[model samples]
Target: MDARRNDVNPQKYYVKKLCKIIYFMGLGDCWYERTEQSRMQKILYAIWATLINSFIILNTINELLAFLRTDLSVKEKNDSIQFRFAHPCLCGKYIFLVLQKHRIRALFERLLEASRSVYTVFEVEKRSVWQAKLCCLVLAASSYCTLLFTVVDAIVGYFTQGIKIRTEVVLYPTPAHSGLLINLLRLLIEVHWWCIVTNMILVDCLSSVAMVYVAHKLMIVKLYFQNLRQKVISNIGKKSDLEIQKEYEMDFITGVKLHKDALWCAKNIQYALGNVYSIQVFESITLLGMCMVKMAKIDINLTFILANGLYLVCVVIITGVYFSSAGNITYEAYEVHNAMFHSGWELAHLSPASRAVVLVAIQRSQVPVFLTAFGVVVLSHNNFISVVRASYSFFAVTY
Candidate 1:
């Protein structure tokens, strides 16, 4: 199948937009073809990327220093003051930025490759187009909602309190007094913070969307096997022994090929996202606990409750979707064996070669497919539940 034939594909449309945004942020240079550009243009892009990335690095360092200074000062004046909640939040953002800076090229390339694999799957099944479209819509909605909420909260806080609210993990020091120049600087800072927050959210959405699409494809593959099984079983009384054997052999070979393709795609997903998954899992666990602690300490007010509640809910939903989709992929792969057995493979008359192929397919399907974080912790609903429970336990102890 020609992956590029789907010029109007919603999945491709959104993924391309995401790549453009990432490139515009100056986080990566691989989004476009460098070979098409002149030498001078390539050098200019390199220079621009370096300057933009350096600015982000310097800003992160300044924020980290400010956080440390404030944390120390608060501890000294009030021994009971613990910045426990803030530390992990800050560290997670820092780690993410550093990793993204260094790994953007590899990450983007792998994501593009995985997306092509998914596109191939869609080409095989016409009905899967609806799933692809729905995935794109969900991603766009999530990204827009997050951006709108962050911008609205920041604007409201700034106008009402004459203080710039950091909507993200950056710990910028507030200005001591209000002036025209100070206000403008604060506005710029807020805009920059908003961009960073938007990028972070988009990255998470992209990764989650990709995983969900893969799960959808896996489900399609499972259905194909199931259909094949039924077809084989139904042919028992209608077909001769040689005809049945030949049909079984052909179908078994096709199933084997499909399974191999699915597994390859699964491996590509793991390679593309393993490191990012590990970091995100750690961040979600720590941040949820911290947010819960902060919410408990705040007075009961509608705004406070809504703000904190939304934050926690968004975190859970995003992480939950990712883990659940990964689990689904594994589940669909493991069902292949059952699909074969139930297809009346035992009753079908097959040649020795056909029997050997069926046996191999069953053996291959026995080992389940899983998406792991850094080749360690498997991403699944069970692990997600464990993380949530652990976060609650930590919150209780700290509170």
Candidate 2:
């Protein structure tokens, strides 16, 4: 009964912590915080709880295997949702070590390559245009095919499966299901669940891509600024106003370059926050829209409406919390702005020959942003298509 006793015991403490880890990793909430319990007892409790809950989840999924075979498993159907709920892939335990030894160097190598390719205009370069377009087209076609398949499958199921097609109506009935208003609310709630899950997944994926790409872009910009900073420092012996200003510009650029990686990391955080912002807005609209549709479809508030509403609220809150940590996107943009002006200033101060070189470097620096923006716009459009298809299933039920 003395849980505290177990706390002092390392083995017991380890087990308890392990259980909490398991629950936190997959399960939504950790209602079982062991403080008063003894170390040994807490450890045992955690191990037992984790095993039991995991078994329940596994068995439930297994029972639904047949249904999943014909329909989508919650995991498959809810890929985006599950993906969003999971921790970012960037936060690995060994990442810092990898970054220290390899990632940083690798990033620098990439920057070097980017720098070498600075001769071409970023947006209008003729060399890679067809290649980029081809890639984009291929990606778009694949995503479109997937979306079409999901749509056709859902439509076929809606017509063939009869009334039982509404998974919420059959499996999650409540006392109020007998009422028309309550059934409609239940339907709305189910729709909300699916939408939230899918949207979150999309946002997570987009965030990951944005973070990595932005980090690389920032790294290149940082290097360029660093070169300028060094140039100014080298010229410090010549103390004329132009030289001093050049030196000052160099120092400013150097600072920007030094903070480039940090700024890049910050941009990723901002992108993730932007994702949260957009997802929250979408979820809010979903709930409100679902409520109106509920009245039209079943004539009452579905019983699960409150539960789904609470879940949505929690998601919104948690995402908002993440967004809060990310701070402002504009801050990173401003830093980039400063870097640009300084680089341009350096070009102006340079001899005609050096000015040409600086101009090329500046042009090259803009390439990554242009390409990334274009990629995101295209990929996200595909994601939008998926979102539409996923929603059609729930709509079929109402029809």
Candidate 3:
């Protein structure tokens, strides 16, 4: 095992390390196994997840009922309405995260499988590796910064005001009167909040990383097609007619196989993400509008407003990145047609059989590959822009 570990590439090593961290946090398991022990572990994790999910749901309901029972003016009514809506949305987001555990595990497994399959084609290629590394770094930096800000903000608030501030999606109910047992309970609640927040951040960041990695795989496949075109052009006139024809046929077959594999990889990714993709889109738009409404309100605290603003920005940026990467995948898939078109097949003087193979390849290349969310929304830069526009419109109306 040590020897095998040492044989791994630096990029893969770092990526696996990050995935392990995510798995240990109960976000998902990258090394999913079907052993008895693995089953037992998963069962335990599921129980814990269900407990946390139930707690959040119950707390949200309690908060909602409490808000409904209170008397308020028009402004307070607006605030209450917003808060009520926001709590359920937040709970739904957490529930989405929890329910996606198995899907996340499947995604990571597919990612590893795809990477291994394509490694020989891209082992020496630095561009995709660098892009993936940059993505991982960005996710890591953002997660750390956000968590640090939450912790420091809470600590500073407590020291300055002698009151603990909650920094998680679900607010814990604490007694107003202070006592030793109450203080201990508050500390435990804070710990639980931190754990939940940390898990949420890790899951989100790792999911983004997985998407970026899949995009890199698509890029590698595209590069392979480009290289195949070069091979077709370079092999021209170098050998006898029969030999050239054979070589072209061989290359064509290889290209088809690689393209099919790439498509299969993409299909797996889409399948894994399909269930939650639309939910994520709706959540982002709704949360962005809610944050904007909170920021517009006159009586909200600056710090709270700033936090929501940061969250809104992060949601926008993350959504943009995800859709942009999906767009790149589509572009790469479509570029195959151009590569085949420019490969100088006409100049190769191929036999009828070889020409037939090239024709089939060209036909296959003409079909554009796309990743869709919930089998409805195609993930692309254009769609990303549309979502942002719609979100902004919603915010304007609400404001």
Candidate 4:
């Protein structure tokens, strides 16, 4: 597909579930081509995104005030705190994303192009593509399962107990209380919670997908290194020795830049999404601890318990997705260094400049490209374990 054309080939990426949710939620206008979306459509989408964000913000504030002002049950308060604190991070995520959408889009386009290059070069493919697909499925499954339990539980609770507001974030003014009016009020409240839930899911899924995308690119870069010999030699079918050395130099330089770009992409991703992940880590611990305390405090219904259990599992899966993706970035960075030697760079007689380029590539790749939050809290499997420990500590104290 030609970027210069007005066609919607790029929309292929947006056809997936992840982009569709972001689209309807109005966070996906950027995904559309210029010709595909009208000015008014973009304006309305922007307005919709803002409204959804505003609703979630107000919902959070309302619930915080409710928790402070009213004497609620232990279970309600726990659930309220858990939902409230966890999703306000979405506002921060939204701000960062929108402000830097164009830059990130360029980076994403590069990743997409690199994916194509990998496919073009290696038709049979290797484990990287499948690995990324598996992660994508895990990410999507996490969101789907959350929505499943959430909607089901919401329906069950509504039928069993009419006009209940979990977080007390009532958006509509249904002050004239009556049977029909009461039902309408309850329904509106449910819709409000759904908006908030959707907001939260959008944030989580987008960030997780971004990590997976970057990791896939890094894996593709690893493929470049893994096949660096074939990659360079393929261009050297009938070339002379000097020409071949120059080709080697050129390919080595490309690999180095590719390595650097992957690292740069990882860091920029950390800039855009790492803070939220950091906040999420603490939020999950707090929420998890509170969930445990709620369990010990009272005998909850099975539906409620099941919802909480799914929430716990998702928290782990989401965090693991982030941490594992980051871990893979570092692992591939180092692997590129090791792969340099195995690339058969020694087969050809080289000049000083070529040798220096190879040396620089090895050195740069040696300093593993790790992602972190605010210079602390490295996103890796090790810290994933730490998150569980911290949550357990919180539960111990709160209990």
- Which candidate should be chosen as best, given lDDT against the real structure? 4
User: lDDT for every model?
Assistant: 0.60, 0.37, 0.61, 0.64
Please, what are the lDDT tens digits per residue for candidate 4 over residues 1-399? Answer: 001222222323532455566668756533433436688987887898778767667755655555553545555556666656665654565555566666556555555454353232232123344555566567557756765776676567768876353334332333234588777656655666666556555666666656665665566566666676775566565777777787677666666677766777777777666676776677667877877777788666877777767877877787787788778777767777777766657755688877877887777778867777556878887888998888889999877
lDDT of 3: 0.61
Backbone clashes in model 4, listed as residue pairs:
none
In model 1, state the lDDT of residue 219: 61
lDDT of 3 by residue, 1-399 (tens): 001222445445555776667556554455444434587877898887567656545655654664544334343344455546645644554456556657666666655554454334445334555666665566455645655565665565578666455443222343354778766655655565445545544544555555666666556556655665576567666767667667666655765676676677677666655544565577667767766776677554555555555667666766776687778778877876787666556755777877887888888878877777768889898999888887888899988
Which regions in candidate 3 have their CA more than 4 angstroms from the true location? 1-15, 32-111, 114-119, 123-129, 140-164, 168-177, 300-302
Q: Rank the candidates by lDDT, best first.
A: 4, 3, 1, 2
By TM-score, is 1 or 2 better? Answer: 1
Which 10-residue window of candidate 4 scores lowest in summed lDDT? 1-10
Q: Candidate 2 at 373: error in angstroms?
A: 12
Q: Give all TM-scores, in the order shown.
A: 0.76, 0.35, 0.77, 0.81
lDDT of 4: 0.64
- Ranking according to TM-score, highest score first: 4, 3, 1, 2
Q: Compute the lDDT of residue 28 as modeled in candidate 1.
A: 58
- Which parts of model 2 have CA positions greater than 4 angstroms off? 1-238, 241-256, 259-304, 311-335, 342-348, 365-398
- lDDT (10s digit) by residue, model 2, range 4-85: 1211222223323433443333322222232465789757767765664454333323323323233443423333222222
